[model samples]
Target: MSTRPAAGRCLVDLSAQDRLRSRAPERAPMLRVLCCPPAGAAAGYWRFLVREDVHVLGAQYPGRESRFREPAAPTVEALAAEAAAAVAAAPWARAAITPGASADVPLVVLGHSMGASVAAELASRLEHREGIRVALLALSAKTAPGTAEVASTGAGTGAGSDEDLREGLDPLAPGADAAMVRWLRRLGGTPEAVLEHPELLALQLPALRADLRVSMAYDRFPAPVGAPLLLLRGTEDVTVDPGGLEAWRPVSTGPVQRREYPGGHHPLADHGDRLLEDLLACAASGRSG
Candidate 1:
């Protein structure tokens, strides 16, 4: 468990002007999808994913983007708690259940890499505490918790020197001082200009390291989540082995399905249409569940 900030302040507060951004607002949305970005990324990563039926809201973590001044969340639990609260208090949540509107507008949660673990915890919190039933819990490029432990005990704990941090990112990127650049190239969402600036990279390190620490140290929840789970993986993803994806089957009480795309790790970039189709189908099923 990592140290939490004082009350009334959090690393990522959706209520803040820049934390939770709407990607598709031109048309009325039948469902709302809250997306969490991969490690070292921000909410703007989902800007390209526009759909009329689904309103995409990106969750912006602190120590990046507009919240660069705020301290990053020390643990995944803390980040999840804050995110859950923000969702519960969001205007969209209220509009979804307003009278004369749709009976039950679905709320889908999607995440990638470290974001996947955070989404799991957020879904659990929302279901248990806020009585909000998530339509779908979609995860990508991440192994199920409690099955395979992320190497958090040693040098990968985010406490090592800058060189160690660069080395740890080698698998995801595989280069030297260009660690951030390589990672962006592989992730396929971040802007090239952001990676090119040394000042921005310096500002991003704390949040990235904190995210890594929480992800590495995360433990599986004691109980299975109630929402249907969909696992997406890339055929070429070296970070998450295909064998470990099946572990998600036992972690959800609802239906569990796994699919592999043609690319590696970042399926949304290479297979956005297929991903969107599957996501919409899953949300429809959740509405009828």
Candidate 2:
């Protein structure tokens, strides 16, 4: 998928201090958010989601950005396990839940499209293995994990043609393939420069292929997630149809929240403001912690 921030928001570099924590830098985040980016994405792909009490920690999949030299994860479970460690080390991780008492803060995970699978797997680890209570699990633009096939309405659905991923392409090629770029454009969310620029495109391809491979093959951990669930879908999104959004019903044991927008596959690009609004609501009300 092609990605760029919509005009409503600006990209925030995690390496630098973020305005999201400017108001309450000293206070441990009342809610810690781990947002997994979709295929062909890296950690910093999340646009700034501002809230004084909330902080979004971008999930860093290997083979991209600072992790460029690291090997890409082999399965959705691998990505989840890596992210689980990061969440367990959050500043409030220890402070939130006491020996027998309830948590003081919420641990929230959000993912869109293929990343949604990663988010679900990560939530399972936190709730079942780490014993960390997940306050919320937000999934957007994807069918429920374990569904056999993708929605027929989506463009280029299923695992995708192997050629579309451009695996093992010339590292020094002058540019990316035009037809592949066009296909990606149809998928939505990728930036134009990334689609057209050779060097940037090359850096994104390997991770994209790996992510898609696992994401397409992934199924839920067979344990129902205990976190409150939030399913966000755009009415116009071809990637996930209405029936697909409804498929998340039996995936969770806690309360479930479903919301619809008037956009497409990339909610952050056009509807990030509303998405944050829903997240804020979920954080306050879904406090199983």
By summed lDDT, the worst window of 10 consecutive residues in model 2 runs over 4-13
Question: Per-prediction TM-score, please?
Answer: 0.77, 0.81
RMSD in order of candidates: 5.9, 6.7
Least accurate stretch of 10 residues (summed lDDT) in model 1?
Answer: 152-161
Runs with alpha carbons beyond 4 Å of true place in candidate 1: 1-25, 95-103, 149-196
Candidate 2 per-residue C-alpha lDDT over 1-289 given as tens digits, one digit per residue, 9 for 90 to 100:
7332221122123422465445335444556677888877877777456455566677778777667777778887887787777666665567444543454656678988877878888888887887777778888888765454453322223454434344223334444355457657867778898887988876777777667667767755446777788988877777776566667767578888889887777766576667777886886786634
Local distance difference test, candidate 1: 0.66
TM-score of model 1 vs. true structure: 0.77
